[model samples]
Structures are given as structure tokens and as C-alpha cells.
Target: MGQASFACDPAQTRGRRVAEEESAFRSCFQRDRDRIIHSSAFRRLKHKTQVFVEHEGDFYRTRLTHSIEVAQVARTISGALGLNTDLTEAVALAHDLGHTPFGHTGEDALNALMQPYGGFDHNAQTVRIVTELEKHYADFDGLNLTWDTLEGIAKHNGPVGDPVPYALAAYNALHDLELHSHAGAEAQVAALSDDVAYTNHDLHDGLRAGLFTEDQIAALPIIGAAYGEVDARYPGLEPYRRRHEALRRVFGAMVADLIDTSRDALAGSGCAGAQAIRDLGRPVIAFSDRLRGDLKEIRAFLFQRMYRAPSVMAQREKVTKVVEDLFPLYMSDPGLLPGRWQRDVAQAATDAALARFVADYIAGMTDRFALQEHARLTGTHVLGDLT
Candidate 1:
């Protein structure tokens, strides 16, 4: 499909921080997407857990799987809206690169530990990874992504206000991201697609984990109608088939709702171009009010039954201790960090700078690596492979 007037045009991109000859065979956004796929940080997402710990089950969504799903959903939404699917997919896939090993639990623990230094924000860490940490390139420290992609990465969730995140602030000072404005429509699509993918897939994972029953979730708003529709159409279906059919419908409803609602908004918004969309100061891509309310109920249900279940909480405590233990040890003995990371520690001019190096090293660890390191360093004969 031809892109809409308000779609981000690769030809008109704000350009990379470090200028490079344009690719003859691909758009800049496509190159950005390909770069993210090949990134070392992206590779580590394979073992980064989301709601379920990586060791608990192979079927549950790791950050890698979730990112791929979000990218898929974002591409569909972007295509339907005649937005730039490449940019959308790039933003979607790169969105979670900064997530710590054990997911939000680990991020939270690490943030608390680093509070004395500068604190941790996964979003900021994501920006850091793309802009600075990926040092493979000879021309620059990071992937050296275009300004458009950088803005999308930094502000996809929304605008940055006072006390902007340290990593982002540092980078933005070098190349301003227009921090107090909404990212373009493609980024907005990526952000909402994250919601759609997670809400739908988390329901699937929750059911598979037996954290909550199908009958229980069937009582929730949008899901109830979905279950009812599945029951009417496939009355005698096997339990597995019934659940799968109903949840697929739920997923369809979310994607459909997002596309339809955003299509209407775009038609009415009088946006002349992508820049106009950015200046609108509101997310044009979003679910309808009805679906938004339905999602709130679903999320609350998950928070109680899935996220905060006793078993999950117990695992959270243990993993939290892993981060807590890892940070200070690495901080006190910079020698403990791997040899490759030693150069950063030796050059540290302050305790805070050294702590940041430690944060960067620990934050990059995969779940299994973090667990193994914790066991080896702290003398806990635990799961070497959290499988």
C-alpha cells in the first residue's frame, strides 16, 4: 500500500547522527530494523523473561518473542493505516531491548539499587543501548540510527518532561530529539501494538500456566463475548481448541479496534504530514474507550492472579536478591567485571560513573548468565541453567 500523507517518509528522514551514504536497496527505516535484529542487545533478549521467569517454561513469552510479536502486530497496524511499516517494525522490535534479565522485577530491583548513583529506567537504557553501548561500528559508538528513529525510541511512550532520563538527556544534548513532543505516527503504532500483543499473549500465557482458568477470564468484558462466540461456533471443541479459538478472537478484537479507531482519528485530524502528527501532542493510535476500559479490567485481573500470585512472588523475591547481590559486588570490585568491560571501569572518574558502568554490565546480562554469575560469585549452588 502507498503510504499516507502523514506517514513517515524515508526520503525525508531527519538523518542519522553520523551521516552515511544512503542504502541503494533499502529505506533507512528498513536498515534500522535490520540493524536492531542483528544487535548484540537484541540477541540477549532470547533469555530475558517477561511475566514468567525464563526457567519456568519454554512456551511463555520472553522479551525476544514478545518483541517479534509486537513487531508483527505493529506492521499489520501500520500497513492498514498506510503508515511506514519499516519504521513501525523497527520501533516495535527495539522497544524492549533495555529490559533486564528477569523482566520488570529485575528492573525494579536494579533501579532501587542504583538510586544512590543515578537510577535505572529501562526506556533510557534502551536509548543508551542503541546510541552508545553497541560499539561494533567504527564510525560511532551506537547503531548511529537516524534522528527520526531515535526520537521514536526515546518518546514513543510519550514526551519527556523535567528531569529527563540521564542516558536520553546525555544523548539528546548531542542531537536534540525534540523531547517534549509526541513521536510520529509510526512510533505511536508501535507503542499501541505492544499493548495489543502483550494483553492478548499474556492472557494465553496465564491460561497455559494455569494461573487463572478460562471460565474465570470468560467473565471479563471483551473476553466474555469472545468466549461466548467461540462456544456458539465450536460448542463441542476440545478444551485446548476452545481456549485457543476464544483468545485468538480476543486478539483480533484488539488489533481491529486499534486500526479502526486510529483510522477514524487520522481521517479527522487534518494532518498534512508526519511533522503535523508529531505536533498534535496526542497519541493518534489508541484503542476505543470501550476497549480501553475492558483492558483495564483484564490488566487488573492479571496483576492480581498472574503477576502477584504467591508462586510468582516467591520467584520474584529470589531473583530480586540476585540483582541486589550482583550490583554491589561488581561496584566494589571492578575487577569482577569481565575483561572486555574493564576499560570502562578503569576510566571511571567518579563513583557514579563507575556505578553506571556496573549497571550497564549487569543490565546486559541474560537471565541464565545473571543466575550463573550470582551462583558462582556468591557461592550459591543453584540453577546454572534456568531451564
Candidate 2:
């Protein structure tokens, strides 16, 4: 299929923060994707948590695996809808770059701790990572990605306004991302792909962890229908195989629905260009109302069964304390930070600035590194056997 009328055209990208010569072999979006893949922040994701902690199990998803899955799903959907697959893949791969060590639990703890210091938002942190954190470039502080790539990453979730996170606001002051308007259709597709990947994989993970059984999941709406079909087609299939078959069906259904729904929305909107889709003030990529309702039911089940289950909650408490302890300790004694980070700490003129630097340092840590650092500092193991 040809590129969609509303697909982001690489030739027309808004360009990078620090101007540089164009690549001889790669399009702007491809260059952005390559840069993200090679970034130090991206490498740290292997040790970051998705739902379960990194040490919980070898089979459980880590941020690195989850991002790869999201990229695969996004590429499939973007290809089906004739969207810009390169841009969509870039957004999907980079979306969670700023997620804390212990999944959402660590993020919540950090946000609570940073409430007075402008608060923590992963999306904003992601913006900060690409704009200022990755320091390999001699010319620029961050990756110096194209404006289109940056806009997609920053606004992939939708329009952001009022009380913007400090990192994003500061960057926007220098290079505006048009925070009040929607991102391109490719970015919208990447955002939805994240939901698709996490929902399906979490269900698989929950079942694998034995927090919830196939019988329990079979009671949900769309997933139930999928299980029913699986059982009917392959009676007496092994339990593990049965679960895989049912969940794969659920995943396929979601991706298919998203493609069809997005195609219809694009057709109805008459968006002849990528910017027109953004100016429409609504996402052109989304699941249908029926699938959205079904997903809501599934999310509720996951929230109650897997996320809130006692074992997971216990782990959350442990990691929360690790972040909570590390933040104030570093704030008071910035000398504890690594030598490079200590230089920034020394440069911090005010307590608030020092606190933010500490936040950045802690946020960048992997789960095991955070635990090790906490143990080193406090002379106690926070994670116990999990470490």
C-alpha cells in the first residue's frame, strides 16, 4: 500500500534542535530511530521493570522487551494503515525511555517526592532524556533528534498544557512542540500500540505468575470469547498452549480493530496531510468503542488481580522505599552521587536545582543499580532475595 495522505513525510520534517548535515543513507525518521536505539538510556531499559521487577523471573517482560514488542505492533498497525512506519516505530521505541526502575510504582513514588520540585512526569522526563540527558554528542547535550521525532515523543499521548513538567517546559521554551495541539497520526498510532502491547502482555504475565488463572480471565468479555473459541477449536489442549492461543487471538483482535477504526477515522476526517490530522484536535488512531469498552474491563481485572495482588504490592512497597530513601539522602549529600553527577551537583546554585539533579540521577537508575546503591548507602538490602 502507498503511504497515507496523512502520514508524516520524512522530507518535510521540522528539523533538529542543533542543525546538522543530513544523512547520506537514512531518512530523518530512520536517523532518529537509530539514535534512540544507540542511546545509553535505551540500554538501561534491559534492567528496568515492566510489571514485575527485573529479578522476579527471566521470562517476565522488561522495559527493553516491552519497547521492542510495542515497536513490532506499531509497525504492523502503521503498515496496515499506510502510516509512516519509521516515525511510528521511533515513537514506540522511545516512549518509555523515562519510566522509572520499578515500573509505575517507582514513578509514583518519585512523583510524590518531587511534588514541590515541579513533580515527575515520565513523558517530560523522556523529553529531557532526548534533549539533554544523553551526552555522547560533542556538539549537543542530547540526541539532537529531528523536530518531528521530538514532537511525536513529547505529545504522543495527546495535547499537554497548563503546569507543564519543568523539563518539557524548559525545552519548549527553546524549541516549541506546539503543546496544545495533537501530535501526528503516526505518533497517535504509536501511543495506541503501547496500550495494545501492555494489555496483552500483562495478561500473559499475570497468568504466568499464577496471580490469576485462565478460568478467571475467561470470565472477561472479549478475552472470554477468545478462550471459548480456543477451547472449541482445540479441545483438551494443554493449559499453557490454551492460554497462548486465547491471548494471541485477543491480541490479534485488538490490532485488527485498531487498524479498521483508524482507517475509518482518517477517511472521515479528510486529512490530506499529517498536520491536518493534528489540527483536527483529536486522535485519528484509536480502538473502536466496543473494543475500548472491552479493554476497560480487562484493565480493571489486571488492576485488581495482578497490579494489586499482595505479592506485587509487596514488591512495590520495597521499591517505593528505595526511591523515597535515595531522593532525600542525595539531596542532603550530593557528594554521594557519581563523579560526573557530582560535578552537576556542585554547579547547582539553589537547593531546588540540586533536588532536581538528584531526581534525574535517581530516575536514571536501573532497578538492580538502585537497589545496590540504596544498600551501599543505607547498609541494608531493600529487595532482599529479589536482588
Candidate 3:
């Protein structure tokens, strides 16, 4: 049997390592999970949008809930395969910490606004949050996470394009090498788990918000079948209750399929249970051809019915404008900012720092807070920038 370098302590999953007992606090992966939990960026996720705006309703999935759901799905798959559940959960939790107030609408606006400065990417900004932006301890700039967790977040997109400047170059380089060679199954699980959560949960949120009718939801083939399977599996629920039950059923199926497919692929590769498989440096998951096709079909159905709907797009437009206006006004003159950031603004000069400062500021706000800031600056309910 191969020796295991780390130990798992479920109770200490989110505890940090201090100077006194840095050797025994938690596993490297566990420390990564804990660091994410304690970071300011993670806390800000509570206010960010998921599929619906924060004000859309109290029950809509905020970025926090979305992160939690993704973590749950990722851990389920990872645990099923004897992978690192804590690591997967941590990565999933921190994945959206850099998301702006209004979800992707805000993200798009931030990208446009910050295009001149290295550009804005939630994934990139997530790295910045842990390694640079966050100010928790006196010794470091970011969270000072473990090499593996940092790599997972940095190369979450895999070897697609563009290189991330990781804090640990060796680990980063190793991960990059692994990607071209194959891809990390755990990272792939985390990525696809996100898709699974969004595919089913967003549809559920939309239906609950009155954005779509039962007939509309049931009309989509993949979604309908998933719902039917759930109903048959556990019947005798009221209509309102059925939607939530169906959502769980769909998510469960996605998780199950991902785990089974990943296991089969690993088995086929003749490296079913090896430490080498765990160190999958790349960002791809090797799924059987059948499961891949099914995932793609499910994604396509969601794109047609949920993501691209005119009603949703219209709201997204409104969300886009809110972020676009709020960012620049604060960037140009952060003296207008509240709390400690205003003090930091008084010390900085030049546009780069200002842009980053603004990015940090905007990224930290909730949907309501962003709106309020807009109202305070523009004197109108609509979003705007003051010079």
C-alpha cells in the first residue's frame, strides 16, 4: 500500500494552523478549506447574486447558497471516489467569492470597466482575493493557502488559455504539466458539480419566482425526465413541494452520474486507485463518452430555457448597468467610499491602484448595497456614475 502524506479529521475541516502547532492543526487540504471559510471574500458571497438578484426574493439562491450547493455536490462525488472532499468543498466555496453583486451581469460590467487594467475575471480575482487582496493577518497579503488548493482555484479552467500567476510556481507548473498530460479528476468534479447545481437549481429558482410555468419546465425533455424520475422515486407530494423535491432529484442524478463516470474512466486508464490520480494537475475530468453526452444535452436544455430567456436577459441588463456605473464612480474617487476603504483611498494615487481598489469595493458589495451606493451618488433609483 502506498503511504498517505495527509490525514483527514472531519471535525477540523475548517480550522486553521497556527504558529504554535502548524504541524498538527489540519491537513494541507483541510487548511485550504478553513482559510476559505475565514476569508472576507467568502463572507461577501452572502450578498452576491446567483441566478436571481438579491432583491428578487428572499428565497432565491444567493451566491453563498450556490457555493454551498456546489460544495455539497463536489464533496459527494469526491467522497464517493475516495478523493479529498474537504478540498473539493473548499474550492467550490471559494470559486464564486470574487463574483460581483449581480452575478454574471455584474461580472461582465466589471470586465468592461477594468479592461484597461489586466481585465476582470472571477477566477483571477478569486486568486487575488486569497493571495493579495484579503487583509486578515499581519504576516501575509492573501490567505496564504496550501499549494494544492491554490492550484485548484488558479487553474480551475484547466489548460484552456492564459497562464495564472500562482503563489507557488512549482505546484502551478506541475498542475499545468498534468493538464496537457491528462487532467485532475477532482478539479473536473468540482467544475462539473458547479454545472450540475446551476442546471437544476436555477431552473427551480426560476419556476419559484414565477419566471416560468410548470408546463414550461415540464416541456424540456431532460429536465422533465429528471423530474419524473424524482417523482416516481418519491411520490405523493403537493405541487409546490414537488418542485423542490424534483430539484434535489435532478441534482442527485447529476452527482451520481459524475461519480460513476469518473470512476469508470479512472478504472479504464488502469490507474484506478493511485496517489498519482489524486495529484491530477490538469483541469479535465475523464468521463465515459455516454455521460459526457448526457451532461452536454442537459447544459444545452438549460441554455435554451433558463439562461437565454428574454425575461431573465432583461433583468440581467439592469444588473449589468448597476455594476458598470457603481464601479467607476468609486474608482475615480474612493473618498466617497464608506468605512476603512475610504482611509486607504486617501493614501493611494494613480489609476491602477484605484481600479483595483474599486474592483475590491464593488466585489465586496451586496445587490442592495450596490443599489444604495448608486442612489447616493446619482440621486436616482437607476444606476449611474458621478463623473
Candidate 4:
């Protein structure tokens, strides 16, 4: 199928941060996707948590699996909307690169610790990872990704404005990402696709973890309707099959709604080019208002039942202390950092700069790594001795 006139055309990308020869066969966006997949930051996501601590159990979703699911959803939505699937996949895969090890809990701890050091924002950290942290290239420090990919990741939620995260603002000064404007249509599709993947998977993971039961979820809005339909068709189905069948239907409904709503928005906007979609001042990709309302109820239920459950909170308290203790220790003596990271610490000229470097070192750790390092330094195990 032909692309929409407003789709992000790979041939027309704004080019990489450090200019280089274009690929012989692959498109710019495809190269960005490949680079992200091969990055160490992306690999670390394997041991990063989505909801539960990484060591809690292998059954729960980790950031790596979550990113793959987001990419799958984004590609489907982008293909349906005639957007650039490669660019959408690139954004989806790289969106969570800067997330700390213990999920949002680790991020919250780091953000609080760094409050005096310009604070921690994962979106900004992602920009830093692509633009400054990764050092694989011969000529450049970070992966020299195209402007489109960078912008999409930076503004994954929306446009950046005043009070921007220090990392993002610093990079933006050198190479402007049009921080005040919306990202391309492909990026918008990727952003909404993240919402869809996380919302549905959290429910699935929650059920699998026994935080809530199928019967309880069967009373929620969209989920309830899905379970009702499944029961009517496959009466007295096996519990495992019934749960999978119902959740898959809920997932399908969300995807279909997103595609339909996006198509309507695109047709009504009369955008003639990719830039026109960005200039429209509102996202063209989104869930319908009714679905959005239903999702809110589902999220509220998850928040109370799964995220805030006593078991999870206990793990959260442990991991929070791991981050809290590690930051101060590394800051007080940069020599404590591993050999590779110590080089950067040695080159720091000011206390604040040193703190930032330490923050970056801590932020890049996997959940297991953080706990291990904390135990090594303090002789106190956060998650107990690893088997």
C-alpha cells in the first residue's frame, strides 16, 4: 500500500547528529532501529523491571519484553495508518532506553536524589544516551541517529518546553529538535502504541501474578465486556485459555479503536505533508474518547490492586533504598565506580559535574547490578544473595 502524503518519508529525514554517509541499502530510520537494537543500553533492559523487581520472577514483564511488545503494536498501527513503520519501530524500541533498573520506582528515587542536580527525566536521559553516552562509533561519542528518531524519543509524550530536563536541554542547544512542536506522525503513532501495550500487558501480568483474579477483572469496562463475549462463545473454557482469550480480545479492541480514530483524524486534518501533521497542534493518533474513559477505570483498578499491593510495595521499599544508598556512596568517592566508569569520574572538573557522571553511571545499571553493587559496597544485601 502507498504511504499517506503526511507520513514521515525516510528519504527526507533531517539527518544524523554527526553527519555521515547514508546507508547503501537501508533507510535512515531502519539504521536508527538497528543501532538501538545493538546498543548496550537496550540490552540492559532485559534485567529492568516493568512492574515487579527483575529478580522477583521471570514470568513478569521486563522492559526488554515490554519494548518488543510496544514495537509490535506500533508497527501494526503505523502500517494501518500509512505511516513509516521503520520510524515507528525505531521510536518504540528506543523509547525506554533511559529507564532505570527497578522501573518507575528506581526513577522516582533517582529523581528525588538528583533534585539539586537538575533532576532525572528518563526521556531526557534517553536523549543523552543516544547523543552523548553510547561510545561505540569511531568518530562520534553516541549513536548518531537521525533527527526524526531523536525528536520522537525526546518528545515521546509531547513537545518540550520551559523547565526542560537538563540532559535534553543541553543536547537541544547543540542540535535543535524543534522542542516546542509535535513530532512526526510516525512518532505520534509510536507514543500512543506505548499506552496501548502497557495498559493491556499490566492487566495480563497482574492477573498472572495473582494480584487480582479473572473474576475481578471480568467486572471492569472493556475487559468485562471481552470476558462476557468469551464466556458466551466458549462456555466453561479452561481457566488459562479463558483468560488469554479475553485479554487478547481486549488488546485487539484497543488496537482497532486506535487505528480507526487515527484514520478519521488524518482524513479530517487535510495534512499535505509530514510537517503538516506536526503543525496540526493536536495528535492524530489516539484512542477514542469512550475507550479512553474505559481505560482510565481499568488503570485506576490496577493502580489500587496491583501497583500498590503490599507485596509490591515491600519490594519497592527495598529497591528504593538500593538506589538511595548507591548514589551517595558513588558521589562521595568516584573511585568506588567500576573501572570503565571511573575514567569519566576522573575527568570531571566540578563537584556538580562529578555528581552528574555518578548519576549517569547509576542510572545505566540493571536492577540486579544495582542490588549487587549496593551489597558489595555496603555489605548489606538489598534483594538477598543471588543464586
The lDDT leader among the candidates is 2
Model 1, residue 376: distance off in Å is: 0.3
Q: On residues 1-387, what C-alpha lDDT tens digit does candidate 1 reach at each position?
A: 789999999999999988999899999999999999999999999999998777877899999999999999999999999999999999999999998989999999989988887789999999999999999988899898888888998898988887887778888899999999999999999998999889888899988988999989999998999989988998889999999999989999999999999999999899989999999978898899999999999999999999999988988988999999999898889999989888878999999999888899889998888998998899873444443
lDDT of candidate model 4 versus the reference: 0.91
Candidate 2 lDDT by residue in tens digits, 213-278 = 888989998888999999999999998898899999999999999999999999999989988998
| Residue 339 displacement in candidate 4 (angstroms) | 1.6
> What is the model-wide C-alpha lDDT for candidate 3?
0.68
Please give the CA lDDT of all the candidate structures. Answer: 0.91, 0.92, 0.68, 0.91
Tens-place lDDT per residue, model 4, 1-387, is 678899999888889877899889999999999999999999999999899988888998899999999999999999998999999999999999999989999999999999988999898999999998999989999899999999899886888878999999999999999889899988888888898999988998998889999889888999989999999999999989998999999999999999999899999999999999888898888889999999999999999999999999999999999999999998887888879887788889987788789879988999888988988889998788974
TM-score of decoy 2: 0.98
- Give the clashing residue pairs of candidate 3, or none: 130-143, 179-282
Give the worst 10-residue stretch by lDDT in candidate 1: 378-387
Clashes of each: 0, 0, 2, 0
Error of 3 at 63 (Å): 0.8
Model 3, position 216: C-alpha lDDT score = 72
230-281, model 3: which lDDT tens digit per residue? 6797787788778777666666766777777776665555553333544444
Cα deviation at 71, candidate 3, in Å, is 1.2
TM-score of each: 0.98, 0.98, 0.83, 0.98
